[model samples]
Target: MAEHGGRDARMRDAEARVVGTVEFVLDVRVEGMVHAQAVRSPYPHAVIRAVRTDDALKVPGVLHVLTGAELEADPSVDPYFGSPRPDQPVVAIGKARYAGDPVAIVIAETTAAAAEAVPLVDVEYSELPYVVDALDAARPGAPVLHEAWPDNNCGSWRLRHGDCDRAMAEADRVYSGTYHSPSASHVPMEPMVCLAQWHGDRLDVQTSAQAPHAVREALERMFGLAEGAVRVRTLNLGGAYGAKTQVKIEPMVACAARAVGRPVRMELARDEMFQTTAKHAATVQLSTGVRHDGTIVARRVSVAYNAGAYALSSPGASGQGLTRANGPYTIPNVSIDCVATYTNTVPTCPFRGAMTSQLAFAYESQLDEIAADLGMDPLALRRKNLLRDGDVYPTGEQMHDLHYDAVLDDLEHAIGWDRPPEAAPPGKARGKGLAIMLKNTLTPSRSQARLRLRADGRVDVHSSSVEMGQGASATVLQLAADHLGISADRLVRGFPDTDVTPYDTTTSSSRTTYAMGLALQRAATDLKAHLRTLAARHWHVDPQDVTVGGGSVARRQEPGADMAWEELLSAADLAELVGEGTFAADFGLLLMDDPHDVHGPVTVHWHQGGAAAEVEVDLETGRIEVLRMHANCYAGRVVSPHRVRQQNQGCAVFGLGPTLFEELLYQDGTVSNPNLSDYMIPSILDVPEVITSSALESDDPRAELHGVGEMALPAVSPAVANAVFAATGIRLTELPLGPESVLRALDERRRNDDQEGTTR
Candidate 1:
């Protein structure tokens, strides 16, 4: 057998993707298949008086036009799907809350026919007053999005530790700042696409989704189907980044297919995909009180997230923002309040780091300000307040196996934080800045795996975890092959099909590898035990005396007495061996109802990240150029070194976009830049020349592997912002620190300097 662990064995470029393969969902063709298109509303907020689909049905090749009213009237259709509160309707029912809310679905014999009929459908609407700003929505007299919620507040989360008021009063100095982060798009290469087919009483859905089981459950509930009646199979996702985790447009596609009695495909256009989901635009206010000795005494954080027209994952995102408001510091007195507000815009869902990134921009930026006030070095201040192994989080969870010191030390050394900034051109100023982050994985999750050892010495592994470009499948294969003492090629991973694979909570919150790896490990162990038992029976030896190794079972006392896996299976008269394993987090012990409950385990594990950046600011044009960047994270143990490096680098670049140039522009509750031409993302030319990253391993056995998916994102923005402040002594409190804001701040500083000089 070939060695697998600690090896750089990864699929090459030519063999990595399924673009031209038969497994691609978009390539799957069914006889008599029809294409589907959505008829969306133009008004941001309006009362839908009527939806006339007669003209759309009259189009050539148009098979059927289904309206929200028709779907709502049918008892089989579940109108809403979401967590904490099921408020998002499959389609706009009586009112259209956002501009892109689908009013009707048009099915046709050809894709072009469906596209031609989309503009023909007429929707009567009475436009109403709307609010787009999150903070404004919470104020009095703002247009109420939902009548049930009088204050236009979707939900709020709060956490309190000690006496914040007393701590602030006794402090020697206090620093406060308000930060804003604009909404951003996911921009996955593949837009939201679903192919739904109904055969007799069963429904099959092929789509680009992060969680097949979650989609299957939503489809079953919406169509009133039995447990096995709905099957969801997800192929290779182009990219997910947390956008495709929840149920989106699957129910609508399934409903259209059932109505037409034919398979239907729905793919969102680039502009329409922008309206489906987005990052929550947030306003974060942070205040910190510190003593002259540089010890952080108390901190207060308030965040308001613009959840858009509907509540998708806003409540949960807000809870995370509140929980992580204190960053990685060990402040004794801390208070945080986060609210998700209802507004007239597209619904917001988890995107990359979700609310943690936005909150870090505020909390970490405030740390720099606090350092300047106390005449302390920023890195020294962070080191002083860094959480130790025995420290407790404000949520009442105790930290264990923390590697913050190691990661921070590595990042600072890599970036040469003690050295002066690199020399810049005549018109540029150079500076270096550092930021640290701490996040907790969403807990109370569950995962299960089933493994089958074939007679041909091959193992088939089945699980509901999606491979959304995160190398999840590859990681599982490596772990299973290593445990089985076999080569990697001997393992075959099955596609995620809910009917065949075991249940898994949605593959978000960076929990797939950690939670699912545990299940796969147990499944492999079970298979080994079964193989040992079969070999013992065949050799007339005690099961305890038989050991499994190197694809063979052997007697411990007799070195020459060994039976191959194939021979043992053949003698047992069994075609294959089956094993099952499950993992359920201790929700009772880890979950807390009160934010002040600091005595319980708050999450499955704590994710830590550190970042340092060297930047050059053009004094004339206000353009910022990233000279170098270094990011370090704790990975516990890396299953695949190549994949881990790629993930860290990719996340670092992803962070650069929102830090410098990406923002979903909106005016009058309508997205102004809905296409790539208008909304800018980081290109190769925009990134730093010397980008580097590293992963830290822990000593604890249970901390064998941790999630690194979103760890690098939360710290990138703050690191850049701090560097910008260092280059020019002006604090930037908003995201996408464009040249206009920088130039304006510089001009104001010049004016203040002139006034002071004249007075002197």
Candidate 2:
């Protein structure tokens, strides 16, 4: 058996976290540090007219108050920062785009002092008309958020293959439906925190961020500093999901620090955290053309994403949403158009599943609709159109290593899909449903790692992948230990520090293990080579004749001549050795035959996964209780079975909230449920009665390791919804499948049935 490939090893930091020894950014404290707080705007859209800081300055312990007017007037600092567009200002400059927008920052010697002065530094504003919905914001007459984008559209994308119109027109039948997913919060245990200090021309920052290097780059650009003048450090995060992916409150705190001439730390309150970022509320329209035999011939999809106030990650998220909206089926012709529109709300970033959940909820639920209309079993319909190895995806990339059938087979066994439907209790109806999806990882990215061999026969691997409770640190150590032929205890794992650790793109998109793991593997190989050279020099043997394996060096000619690493290093008069490796996923269109195609492959590999759900719905109240859930994924190779399964189970629970109870409530452009007391998330009691998860391993020798972070999430909501439809013969297309909505749909269904009966 492999040393660590298939083992169900425990997480490296599990003990530390359980014992309360893990250090998050919130626990970090710098000497002479001050506290900072923001004064938020009350209007969704308003023009700043005057500043009133005299009263705030009178507050005891308040050191400085920095306003948007001062920030805009400063020639050294660039106020705007964001991806795809630089429209989001560090503080509201001439105008505040949304409610809760920061208009001024107050820095004080204590947290209480800063909090006390925040309300005293209120600013004057002239309110303007605002639009909150994506569809309404995109119309011509709606309130425009950005002048550059007059139509209030942030970004747009289109993917066309073959002839969708012709195929749809010539199909046996066509079905269309629209699905909606409301904005939701990540609600990580630890709210956002940032601490920044300046030393001469150099600046240092420690934050709870998933992308420290990206933060460093943004800081440098914002301050016009040298490339390496700024250093960003990220410790273990309580939980980020994607809330902490990009720049958030760092610049504001940095500016406050500069004003106060002291280290400034800001820990956002729960309400402030809600105002920071959210998952994009999306509307997806799908039209599928299918034959009488359950073959899908054509598909067209339109997706409009509410980008909120900025285009931080909308371009990539919406484009990927369009691609995944095609589902895991084979269609000869496909066309997709996805757009992100600006709205008067808190900006949206990536969530747990990125952009896959909402799209999956739309297409997968509609697939069951098609199967029902055609009088065919839903499972049979999915099997007939499932994409397999050697198939060409709509993105023009050739597919390989697909294990959708295996995943489906596992789901079937877990849920007893072939068994007869069981009877429900008095007022309940029982049903079963299945859904499958294809997710893609971030591509054209890179990761670098360094392995240092110590004189004590130990190894230290420096990596920039943040833990964030995803088992990345543990996975890295496992891969390195296996490659070095050493026990895990002999290896030391390093967290993310831009000054010491190597560069990584970010921790989202589920690419850390695949990209960073390969980098570590390469670094281990390089270190082994260095060990062999050092051993050969000490023993007066040819370098090629010496081998380094099993944590020791041996002369190939003499089987009994093996020297321990520490002994060999001491004999060679060397204190330590270092090895560096880098992995970049840059190439694309590997098998595309079309020379005119300019768009490269959007993902490194497709994550094929599926879920099966057994639910009991109350016919009288339209309440749903998920009895059991089984999630399966084509994980290619398993590093730690325990971690993979744990991730899948967590994903099911995470997906459950958005499916049944979670939604950000907006009242007149401001979030009403910003705190835990109002916003409901899944708790221990909400877990399904019987939940099972598995990762299918590939038998092929060339199979590669695929990240399982987001593999099982996309199908969760759709599976539960499909089961509900099967139980009641009523289709609901909206999210958060609340009791009120379900009951309303049931009443409407009954009325339709009565009308048809009268006609009959």
Whose lDDT is greatest here? 2
- How many steric clashes between backbone atoms does each model show? 1, 0
The local distance difference test score of each candidate is 0.84, 0.87
lDDT of predicted model 2: 0.87
Worst 10 residues of 1 by lDDT: 1-10
Which residues of candidate 1, in runs, are more than 4 Å off?
A: 1-5, 12-23, 588-591, 594-599, 699-702
Backbone clashes in model 2: 0
Q: Where is model 2 more than 4 Å wrong at Cα?
A: 1-5, 588-600
How big is the positional error of residue 256 in model 1, measured in Å on the Cα after superposition? 0.5
632-750: candidate 1 lDDT, tens digit per residue: 67888777767777777887889999999899988887888999999988899987999988777765544557878888888999999999988888888999989988899899999
